[model samples]
Structure formats: C-alpha cells, structure tokens
Target: MRILQQMNAFCVMTLIAFSISASVQAESPAPVQAAKKALAVGQTAKDFQLLSVGGELSGEVKLSDVNADGKVVVVVLRGFPGKQCPACSAQVGDFVKNASKFAAKNAKVLLVYPGPKSQLDQRADEFLQGTKLPAPLTFLLDPGYTFTNAYGLRWDAPRETAYPTTLVLDESGKIQFVKISETHRGRSSAAEVLEAL
Candidate 1:
C-alpha cells in the first residue's frame, strides 16, 4: 500500500511536468513586445494645451510647478463611445475616494481625457458629471488626441481609443514613474500609484 501511494505521487508529478512541457511546446511563440515609445523614468514630460469644461487645459498645469511644489499624478482616460470604459470610470472613482491620500503625499492629480475635438467638451463633461472631485484633482481633455500623440499613448486599434495610462512627474516636469497599458483593463489605482510615488 505504501509503495502504491508513492507511485501515485510520482505519477502526478510526472504528469504535471509533462503537461507543462507540452503546453510550452504547443504554444505559438510570441515575439518580444517592442519597448514602446513614451516618457520613461527620469525623462521630462512634455506640455500641451487641452480642452476642458473648466477652460484652459494642457500646458496650463506645468510639471515644474508640480515637482517644485509637490508630486504630479496624471491619469489618462479613453474617450467616450469606446466600450463605455467601465474600468476607467471605476479607476477615477477609486482615486477620487483616495484624493486626500495623494494630497497627503503632496501630489496633485490631473485626469487626462483624450477624444476628437468635436466631441471633447461633451464627453469630458459626461465623465465629470456630479462627481465631487477634490480641488487638487483637475480634469483635462485632449482634443484631437494631440497630447496622446505627443505623449506616445495613442492606441491604433480599429475599434480602439487612446491608451489609458498613468504618469507621475516630478517638480521639474521629469517623469518619476510611468505606467502604460496595452489592453483596456488596466489603469493604475490610487494606492498602487501612491505606492509608486
């Protein structure tokens, strides 16, 4: 009976091992994802003018002022009509819930919404409707996706939209941290981003 148990365990181990090896062999090899062109750590973040419900977006918020005063958290959002983007809405809600935590860390948050200029105003307002954003958080719009192109966060899929990403820029406007998602599922959380800071 003892030998039978040992054989069973050995067979289980061997099966797992063979299954893993076969899976690896049968899988189509994936090419290495090219290093995407975007702001890297220690690189200076560029500036641009954005269309906003509040008027005067983009270059208005300087990275230097942010770094010299406190930290800057820039969250990018995919525009409206791009699958409802429940993930993005949830992400912003979560961050707004923890807005104070970011303030305690001396960071100002800017949410960047990118869409075509014609629809930017309406779409941006839809995202900010009735949401009590703390004073520290500013919602900015990228009309015509100039900022997306400049920041290298444009997603070129047929039915896709801009890349939903997060960037932490220092006082001098240099990127202290950056996170860009290829898929639509991920945009950094407030806790996750604060920890990065």
Candidate 2:
C-alpha cells in the first residue's frame, strides 16, 4: 500500500512538472533576430535582380546590366509600411522630374519598393498609378524585403519597411556615394545625386 502511494505521488509530481514546463514554454518570448550590417561607400555593391514594378520593361532587372551601361543610382524607398509614405512619393517625383538630367549624366536610377510578400505587387502598382517613370528611371518591387535585407537597409520596426537610402555605383559597381536615412525625411535630393555622378 505504501509503495502504491509513493508511485501515485511520483505520477502526480511528473504531471505537475510537465504542466509547468509547458506553461513556461507558452510564456517564453520569441528569440530576437540578429542585426545586419549596413552597406557603405567604397565597397562594391552586391548585384541583385528584382522584378520591375512600373516601367517600360516588364521583367527582372539585373544591377550588373544597368551598371554596364553607365553609373547606377539605387534609391531605396520606404515601401507601403501600413500606408503610403508621402516622403517617398515626393522623392520619387523628384527623381522622375530629373529623369532627363540623370540620362544626360549617363546614370540609371533604380527605385526599390519593399514590402510584405502579400499584395506587394498590387501595392507597388498602386504607388505608380499617376507617376510615369521615364527610360532613365526604373521602379522595382522587393517582395518580402529580399534585396533590402541583403543590402542591410531593412528598417525592421513597427510600421516600417526599409530605410530611405541612396547609393551611387560607378560603372565598375563600386559604391561612390551612399546615404542612409533612418527617419522619414533626410532624403538625398536629385541635385545631390546628380553631382555625385
């Protein structure tokens, strides 16, 4: 009888321990993701291929292909982070207006729009509704921030996508100028980029 009682006690303790373990697991916080390094000037920018969102072309655009023609201006926009960013719209508009100037300098502008995989294409299309990107400028979609994270520009925060960034890559793919803005403002102007080229 005593042995049976001890066995019962042991079973109860095991059940309690299991219950506590499960509860602890259920209450545990998620693991934090490691931070990524930011891309800098003087470094050769990694080549990437992203689908063109709104442009004359309708397929994948390779960085190397664009750079082969001339210098490349890579603009990273804060994609639809819960809502349309007015600053992004303004920056894009400015670039569009300066399309001719960029062309004159033999520089191709690549605007990267990053967001969640779901409805990313639709959101990007919406962004380009009234704006017409000329031949000198190309709009690219970054589904799930594949290229953004790869370039260390992901702004991983609440209602945030990628940090507004501008990079000037020489014909040889070496980064000659780079500006990364953590806030919504502080964007590089087209004139500044034009001078960089």
Among the numbered candidates, top lDDT falls to 2
Residue lDDT tens for model 2, 139-163: 9999989998888777878999988
lDDT, candidate 1, 59-173, per-residue tens: 4655455456767888888877454578888998888888788878878888888877786677777777756677567787777878877776767667666777899887678
Q: Can you tell me which runs of candidate 1 are displaced by over 4 Å?
A: 1-37, 54-68
Error of 1 at 134 (Å): 0.8
Give the alpha-carbon lDDT of every model: 0.73, 0.86
lDDT of 1: 0.73
TM-score of the candidate numbered 1? 0.75
